[model samples]
Target chain A: MMPTSPVIPLFVAVPLAGAFAIALLGKKTRIIPNGMALIVTGGLIAFSIIAMRMFSLFGVHTYKLGAWPAPFGIVMVLDGLTAFMLFTVSLIAFLVILFSISYMERYSGRWQFYTLFLLMVAGMNGVIVTGDMFNLFVFLEVAAVASYALVAFGTEKHELEAAFKYAVMGSVGSLFVLLAIVWLYSYTSTLNMADMALALQAAGSTRVALVTGVLLLTGFALKAAIVPFHAWLPDAHPSAPAPISAMLSGVLIKALGVYAICRVFYSVLGVSPQLSMLLMVLGVVSMSVGVLLALRQWDLKRLLAYSSISQIGYIMLGIGIGTPLGFMAALFHLFNHSVFKSLLFLGSGAVEYATGTRDLREMGGLGKRMKLTSAAMLSGSMSVAGIPPFAGFWSKLLIIVAAVQAGYYWFAIIAVVASMLTLSYVMRIMRYGFLGELREKWAGVREVPFMMKLSLGLLALICILGGLLLLPGAREFFLTQAARTFSVGTQLASRILGGV
Target chain B: MSKERQPGMTLIVKTVTRLTVGLILLYGIYVVTHGHLTPGGGFAGGVVIALSLVHLMLAFGGDVAFKTLSKSGAAVLEAIGALLFVGIAIIGFGWAGFFFNFLPKGTPFDLFSAGIIPLCNIAISLKVGAGLFSVVIAIVFLRVAGSERE
Candidate 1:
C-alpha cells in the first residue's frame, strides 16, 4: 500500500482559504484579489501535478481526515482518475482565473467574483477528491451554489432570469442527489463509498438499489445537462460573464455531471447492461438534439452552450460503450473538450469584449482585426469540429472506433453524423462571425489584452497538442491508468478499501 | 423619543427586543461552546446569534443595526470566521494529519473538553452568525432601496 501524501487535502484547503482571504483583504485594494486568485490557482496546478506524480508512483493513496479510520471518518482518495480530474480542473481554473484578470474589469465587485471563483474551485476539487458519498454531495452543492451566484453576477434582467432558472433546476438536481445519498446511507448504513460498495454487493441488486440508481442518474444527468435536462444550460452559460462562461462550460459541468456519473455508476453502483444502453441512448439524443439546436442560435455564447451538450453526448456514447477503449476515449474526449471548449468560450468573450455584442450577424470579418483571438477561435473550432490532426478528431475517432468494435455499428453511424453536425454549426460561427466582410462599425476593433490572449494562446496550444496524450508512452502513463480504475468495475471497492 | 416617530416599530416591540436580544446572544454562545455535549452546535447556535441581531434590526431599524454591527463589519467577521475554521484544520497538518485533533482532550462533559471541537464550533458559529446577518442585511437593504425608488 502506498503511504498517504500530505498534499492531497491542500487541493480543497488552499482554494477555500484563498477565497476567504480574498473576501477579507480584497476590499482594501483591487490587486489583492487578483494576486490572491493567481497565487491560489497557480498553487493548485502545482499541487495537482504533484498528485498525478504521486498516483503514478503509489497507485492509490487515501487520506483519512482527523486521523480517523475508513468507514468511520471522511477519507480523501487520490488515484489515477482523481489525479486526472484534478489536473484538468486546476489547469482550466488557472487559465480562467488568468483570463478573468482582464475580462472581469467591465463588471463591478471584482473581489466578489474572485471569491466565488475560488469557492467554486474548492468545491470542484473537494468533489473530485472526496471518498465519502455524503461528502461528495456537500462539495457538489458548494460548486453548484457558487456557479449559481456567478451566473447572476451581472444582475441584468436576462442574467437574473437565467440565474433564477439555473438555481431552481440545480436545486432540484441537488435535492435528488441528497435524497439518493440518504437512501444509500440507509441501505448500507455507511457513507464511505468503498464500504457501501461492498455492502451493496453483499445485498445484491434489489428494488431499493434500482430506485437509488434512477435517482442518482436523474440528479447527475440534470447537472450534466444531458439532452432533456439541458434546458437551463443555454440560458445560464450565456448570461454569465465570459470567463465565467468558459469556466461553466469548460469544467463545471464535466466535474459535477460527467465525473459524478462515471464514479457513482462504474465504481459504486456497478453498471449493468441496461444502464449502459440507457447511457448510450442519452448520449446519442443529446448529441443529435444539441447540435441541431445549435445550428439555429445567433448568439455566439448560446451556440457554444448548445455545442457543449452535443460534445457531452460524444463522451456519454464513449462511456456507455463500456469497453476499455471506450473509457479511454471518453476520458480523452472529455479532456480535449475542456481545453478547446474553454478556448472557444474565451474567444467568444474576446469578441464580445471588443465589439460589445454577441450576435453572430453583427460580428463580421473579425479575423482581420483581432488576429490573435480569431486564430485561437479557429484552432478551437477546428479541434471541436474534429478536423484531422486536432485533439477533437482523435477522441471522436476513438469513440466511433470503440463503438464499432463493440458491435454497435448504428451508434457509430449516429456518432459520425453528430460529428458532421458539429462541424456544420462550428463552421457557421466561422463564416458569420469571422470570415465575412468587416463591419463598418467594427473598424476600430483590436485584439484582446495580453493576459486574455496569453490564456487563449495557451489553451489553443493544448488543443493542438491534446492528441499527443494518446502517444503510447503517455497513453500508458495517463489514460490507461484512469481507464483501468473503471475497467475493474466493482472490484474498485476492494482496491480502495485495501489502501486502508 | 415618541413611539410613532421612531425609525422602526412600536415602543413595546423595541422594549421587548432590547430585553431579549442580549439573552439570546448569550444563549447562542453557550450553545456553541457546549456543542460537543448538547444537541445544538455551531449551525444552530450561529442562527440564534444572527437572529439576535436580526431581532435588533427588525425592532429598532437599520440605523440601530448599523451602529451595532455594520454591513462591512458582518462581512469581515464572516470572512474571519471562515479563515479561522480553515486555519485550524490546516494547522493540523503539522501534527498527525489534516483536521487531526491535536489539542489535549480535557474531560468528557466538561466545557473545555473535546479538544478542537469547541474551537471548530466557535469558528463555525462566528462564520454562520456573521454570514446570516450579512445575508439578511443585504436583502433588507435591497428591499429598502427598491421601495424608496418608488
Candidate 2:
C-alpha cells in the first residue's frame, strides 16, 4: 500500500524555519543557536527513523503539495531509497552539528554558521524528498550556495581562494544540470521525475534522452568529485572548518551527486549497458587515483579529502554492476562510508582542535594523551580501510564478490588492489600522525571539549557496530529495501504514479 | 562649492533622487499587491522595492541609507520576511496540505482577492528588498574595510 503522510513536507519545512529562527534570535543569546541546532537536528533524526519504518511497512509514501494530484503539482516521495538517504543525511548532520558546537567556537559568527548549516540540511532534505526534477536542482543550489559560504567562513587567504574555485566549478556543474533539466523538459513536457520516466519510457531511448543523460552525468559527476572533475575538493574540503569538512565529505557528495546519478540513470533514464560500463570505468579510476594522491599528502584533512574520492569510487563501482546484489552493496557501502568518513573527519577535527595544526610532520604520539580520539581515529581508519569486522570491509567485500559473480573479474581485481592501497595510506596517517612518539611542542594538548568528544565517541561507536547493519534481519529492513528501488528500474514510475 | 565637497553625487542628482525615490517605492508596492492579476509578482516587485533603497544609497552616502535601515535592521527584516512566507505555508499545511493556498480566491481583478498571495507577495518583498539592500551594504562595507587596510 502507498500511504500519504502529512509529515513528509516537514522534512524540508522544519529546518528551513529553524534556519531563519536562528538568523533572527541567534544574536540575542549564545545558547539559543546551540539549543536550536541540537533540537532541529535531533528532531530530524527521529523523524527520519520513523520515515524508514513507515517505508518498510507501507512500501512507498508520497505527499502532494497544495492537495494537488501527482503529475500536476509537486510531490514529496518517501520510498525505501529516499528513506535510506534521509536517515544517512540526518544522522550525519546531527553528529556534525554536535561537533560544531565546540569546534566552531574558534571562529566568529556562530549565528551565521548555524543558519547556513541548517539551511544546507534543509536543502539536502528537500533534495532527498522531492519528486520533482527541477525542485531537486533548486534544492541542490540551496545546499551548494550555503556550503560555498561556509567554506569561506574563515576568511583566510587559502580558504577564500579555495571557496572561489569551488564556487566557480560548482556553478559550472549547476549550469549543466539546469541545461539537462531544460532538455528533459522540452523532450517530455514534464519536470516531475515519475512523469518524465513514464514519458521517456514511452518515447524510448531517443537521441534527446541520451544527450540529457550525458549532460546530467557530467554535472553530477562534478558534484560527486569523480576523479577527472575533482580539482576543487582537495582544496575546498580541507579549507573549510572541520565540521563543515565532515558534512562535505560524509553526506553532501552522496546526497547531491551519487544519489542523483542513481535516481536519474536507473529510475528515470533506464540505464543502458554503455552507461554502466562508463560508471565502472569512472569508479575504478577514481578509486586508484584518489588513494595515490592521498599517499603523498602530509596535511591530515587533505589526505582524508583525497581518501573520500577513493571511497566514493567503491560506491560507484558497486552501482555500476547493475545487479540486485550490486545495488545492495552500493547502498550498504554508501551508508557505511557516511558513518566512518564523517567519524574520521571529526577525529581529525579533534586533533586540529587540540594541536592547532593539520600537518602530519608536526604531530606525533598524541594517542596516549587523547585516548578517545585516537581510538575513534583507529576505528574509523580500520573501517575505511576495509579491515575485518568493520562496516567498510563487508560492503567492499560484497561489491567485489558481486563483481566477480557478474563475471567482471578485472573490475574485481581492481577493487581489491584499491582496497590494499586504501590500507597503505590509512596506515601512513596512523604512523605519522598518531602512532609515533609524542612531540615536545604538543605536550600540553588535552582531549577536546566534552561536546566534541561525545560526538566523536558516538560516531566511532557506530563505526564499530555498523557491520551489524548487514546482518540478515537488518539487511532486509534497510539495504534490501533500498536496493530494490534501483532494481525495479523504470517500473518505479508505475509504482509511484499507480500508487497515487 | 561647499555642496560639491559632500561625499555624494552632485546636488542635482541628490535632489532628483529625493523627488523620485518615494515614487519608486510606491510603484514597487503596487507591483507586489497586484502580482496575482498582473505579470509582475513577488520577485519582480521585490527587486523594484530594493532598487528604491539602492537609489537612496547611491544618491547620498551609505550613511544616509544606514540611518533609514541599518545592516542589522535589514538582517532582521530579511529573517522576518522569510518567516512570514514560511508561516503562511505552514498555516496552509495546517488548514489543508502544504502550500495548499487555504485562503479564499475572491473576485478576479479585485484588490483584496487572491487570499494569501498578496500576503505572500508582501512577505517576499520584505525579504528580497532587505536581502538585496543588505547585500549591497555588505559590498560597500567590504570596500571600506579594504580601503582601511590599504
Question: What lDDT would each prediction earn against the true structure?
Answer: 0.93, 0.92
Interface RMSD of each: 0.5, 0.8
* Fraction of the reference Cα-Cα interface contacts (below 8 Å) that each candidate reproduces: 0.92, 0.79
What tens digits encode model 2's per-residue C-alpha lDDT throughout A1-500? 45898878988999999999999999978899999999999999999989989888888899998878899999888888999999999999999999998998898899999999999999989988999999999999999999999999999999999999999999999999999999999889998899999999998779988999999999999999998999999999999999999999999999999999998888788989999999999999999999899989999999999999999998999999989999999999999899999999999989999988899988889897899999999999999999989888899999999999999999999999989989998898889888889988888889999999999999988888988988898999988999999888888888889988
Stretches > 4 Å off in candidate 1? B1-4
Clashing pairs in 1: none
**lDDT, candidate 1, B38-61, per-residue tens:** 999999999999999999999999
For model 2, how does the per-residue alpha-carbon lDDT over B15-120 read when each residue is reduced to its tens digit? 9999999999999999999998998978888999889988999999888878888889999999999999888888886677888888888998898898888999
What local lDDT score does residue A455 receive in model 2, on the 0 to 100 scale? Answer: 95
What's the lDDT for candidate 2?
0.92
True contacts kept of 1: 0.92
